[model samples]
Target: MLASMPGLRPDQEGPSLAEQMTALPVATLVVRPDNSIADANVRAETLLNMARSAIIGSDVARTIRIAEAGARFDIWHSNKAVAAYDIKVHAGRTAEMELDLMIAPIVDHDGWRVVSLHAQSQARKIGHRGSSGGARSAMGAAAILAHEIKNPLSGIRGAAQLLESSHNGQDSALTQLICNEVDRIAALIDRMQDFTTDRTLECQPGNIYPLIDRAAGIAAAGFARNVRITKRYDPSLPSANINDDALVQVMINLLKNAAEALEHVPKPRIRVETAFRHGVSVMVGDGKGSAVLPIEILVIDNGPGVPEHILDHLFNPFITAKRDGQGLGLALVDKLVRDMNGFVQYSRDREAGESCFRILLPMGMA
Candidate 1:
């Protein structure tokens, strides 16, 4: 509710109308009786990707375009509050943003309305913070990997060296790839040597399909050897802001989990897919504003879905459906993606009889 409106007392002890608008978490715009934007809060500026100077005094109809072709702007004609969900807001020449909107007419001011806009993906904001149990588990797992995994990596590197000398052409290249991959794993382990869990990943603009392909190849070469895998990539997907290594690990973990789930299925099939989701955005850790995350990566398997008993706690640390599982994989996957400003979710597509792990990430430059 706004303060110092026509119905409020002049000596109201709480925050002023301007202060209330400024402090609102959701993006807000106060429209004048003429349907011109009288004022917009900082959140509004962020949502529209425009400055206050550009937004204020502009005709609301000209500045904010409701992307629904048949929808009419009738809030000014009625006093009743208006609420809409899954609406696309296209401001100026900017990309269309998906948001829920609420417009309520000012109590005594005719043709005046307060508009609130919130992103559809606002609830999926997951970022690294020190106190989360997942972070603690990740730190412990990192220490263990740094100590235990390094020694085996060395032995593998040596074995690859022994094979490289006896191989030729394509075989030699395979051996070389093994050696290179081992070294990369070793470097990642070295970074995990730190137990602080406060290290930030180096993220850059990159297409995720190649990383998905790499993960699928690794999975097929080992745990998922018997499982049929397919790819359904959106050819026009934009680049995503990502740490390539982290993303590959996340995909590999999900694939491995799905493969394990299908261990006893009659005909196991896993599908890896990517697409662009319109208006999918999440609030960042900084709390300043939200980041539009249109890049979606999905790993789906026709397995007997996650067990109902542990489904609610699926992403939490040490939660597992496997009898001998350490349960660190999903937790680590969650941490890694969140560290790169992305989020992961799990769902069962009952109609398709598939277990799906979906990841949404911010867009990177082309």
Candidate 2:
């Protein structure tokens, strides 16, 4: 719609084509094959803080740079339109913009792209060229800090226990508080050490339906008591090559997360689905080899959605939206999934009004 205006031409009198684009909320740009901007909307002008005369016939890459995760400029090189999802792109020289980018080819024009930039609030802090080293640094710091603090924490806990047994009246409560707080800190440290552990994962081919049922039964009795859960299981699905217990941990954590998100909602529903989608693979080893991953499981919830600020880095440790949250649950899930040679990602169906977390696992061996 941004690219084509019905029955409207440049020579028309009364509020010409450019005026129509000015009224659009999204920043629209028509780009030449050489990456020069042929046209832009008023919103684009405002976003870039430039006049039409300055924006038109200029290089869009100089105005804004686009990156898709680690693969920068994948959208521009590709030939299809990626829709309904938000993308994080490095804008200007040092700024970032997360927006809904839709690229559509012109009707009759060859080698031209119509790029629409619809702004959103979430800024993906990861996936620039040099950002991973910083993340690894943070993880290393967490591991070292947890190990160093545990020694002092052990002494404090022992002293608290001694004082609590000897003290009476209100002093007893204070010592008990110290002991409880010490235990909590120790538990948090134990969780953090999981990230630093180089433990080898042992996975076997196993059916996931019974595992899902087991987790669902547990959540129904406990964390998800207030939520309504439904399952759409593909009974004929093959065995997923994952550790069954590890997969259960992933499921339980996901369910707890969904339950927490739905706490304030009047009607809370979580849908667990499994399907066998064929022919899904990514190129590996010089782009000639394809690794197939067809076993799909999706956890969908009718909650509001992931917050915009943390959506991009939801799986990154220490990035969380919940109060009193250490932000390691989803990160652990990602690590576990990757350890099993699988992939997990978070997405939202804006039109259907649901948030989806999908896991793709191999059947046996890729």
Candidate lDDT values, in order: 0.76, 0.73
Top-scoring candidate (lDDT): 1
Poorest 10 consecutive residues by lDDT, candidate 1: 122-131
1-366 in candidate 2: lDDT tens per residue?
Answer: 344455867665455566776777778998888878999888887776788788888787667664443431244554444332334556544357556556677767776888877665222222111123333554697789887999999999998888777765448878888989999999988888777865668988888888888999999999999999999988788888989888998899899989988989899999999998654443223222334568998999988888898867777788889997888888777777766666677888889999888887878654
TM-score (all chains, Cα) for each model: 0.54, 0.64
**Best prediction by TM-score:** 2
Candidate 1 Cα errors over 4 Å, as ranges: 1-132, 137-196
Q: List runs of model 2 lying over 4 Å from the truth.
A: 1-139, 168-170, 283-288
Model 2, CA-based lDDT: 0.73
Count of steric clashes across candidates, in order: 0, 1
Residue 175 Cα positional deviation in candidate 1, in Å, after optimal superposition = 32
Q: Between which residue pairs do clashes occur in model 2?
A: 122-308
